[model samples]
Target: GYSYSNTVPGPIGSILGPAKDPKANATLPFACSLCGSCTDVCPVKIDLHHQLLTWRKEIRVKGFLPVSKRISMKMMSWLMQAPRMYRFVGKMARSIVPYLPRFMLYNRMNDWGKQRELPIIPKQSFREWMKQNHDDK
Candidate 1:
């Protein structure tokens, strides 16, 4: 039921508005869900999602992203590339997150947790499960 017009206005305003402040418009691109719904509905077949991704890259390159977000992104990138470290962190999270106080997990710093409840942590990782269930077969 959502319309492309809803998402189009922000980017259009940022591009056409007299003030060319990247910092001011930095949040505009990220406002999108990147679901490609806008692109699907565009009459001109514009790649709105891709354009939004480009804007995000430009904003990050221009250092408009907040310091906390930048550090978190870097940390995630590092963790993702190191498989052993990633597994260790995952195990640690599974073991520690549920026991952590609400304030610790749902604070202002946890933007993802602000409006949503964390999912119940599983007893074992998917890798462990797969090994147990499939490797013997």
Candidate 2:
């Protein structure tokens, strides 16, 4: 759980490089949310919740994910942040809602799925919601 980075340089401090080891990263194991979305979204239908927990143990617990995968995740975060591009994708998502599978579209595997309904995407956006509900008065 402790980060020791004397081998390479990272942002903030270098745990794997030259800075003193951080007391630790999170020590807790990934607990199962048992959300079925993983299963539903899985192209191969693997029980991803189980797989996720397993990977968490192997990776977070054992330092197992490939470096490429870690880099790709960082890349994905960057790609997701462009407002115009993200909005284009959001529009596509809304357009595709009618065709999205129950598992992926509905968040069915999520623990809260049992009690929660897939919220209707409103015709009006959140800004509209705020405008209707929030008055200077």
Candidate 3:
């Protein structure tokens, strides 16, 4: 089910597909996985992933994306682009996740955790573990 979106050209070509309605195309960008596999399999070699990314940017600019998705994307972008913030958030998540109640983390706000248990943060980061282990060498 997860890979279906990427394997087929429906979501990728929603904007340019045979559909005559704009409403049908507007939501198409969200369904694509943007995995580029479609482009590879296409007879004409269209850049499916690139177009999907462009459509996503256009959708964001048009303010069509849901607020929750937009906010989460913003947070993720910031977390990845800023190493300090990433480290801080990693430490905070690790320290707080264990202490927090299941209801708080597994609630409606967290769709990712709805289906399964959340990941357990390790006691030490890779950097810390390497530092300790390599100190003797």
Name the top lDDT candidate. 1
Model 3, range 1-137, lDDT digits (tens) per residue?
23322223564455463133333355566666778787889788888778777777877776777788889888899889999888788888878889988889898877668778977789877777889888776
Flag the better candidate by lDDT, 1 or 3: 1
What TM-score goes with each of the models?
Answer: 0.72, 0.33, 0.63
Q: Sort by lDDT, best first.
A: 1, 3, 2
Candidate 1 Cα outliers beyond 4 Å, as residue runs: 1-21, 31-44
Least accurate 10 contiguous residues by lDDT in model 2: 10-19
* Model 2: lDDT of residue 133: 93
Task: Give the poorly placed runs of model 3, Cα more than 4 Å off.
Answer: 1-46, 130-137
Q: Which structure is stronger by lDDT: 1 or 2?
A: 1
Model 2: runs farther than 4 Å from truth? 1-76, 103-115, 127-137
TM-score of 3: 0.63
Q: lDDT (0-100) at residue 26 of candidate 1?
A: 65
Return whichever of 2 and 3 wins on lDDT.
3
In model 3, which residue pairs have backbone atoms overlapping below 3 Å?
A: none
Q: Predicted candidate 1: what Cα RMSD to the true structure?
A: 4.6
lDDT of 1 by residue, 1-137 (tens): 01222332554543322135667566666666789887888888888778778877888988898888778879999999999999999999999998999999999998678789999999899999999989976
Give the C-alpha miss distance for residue 79 in model 1, angstroms: 0.8
lDDT value, residue 75 of candidate 3: 87
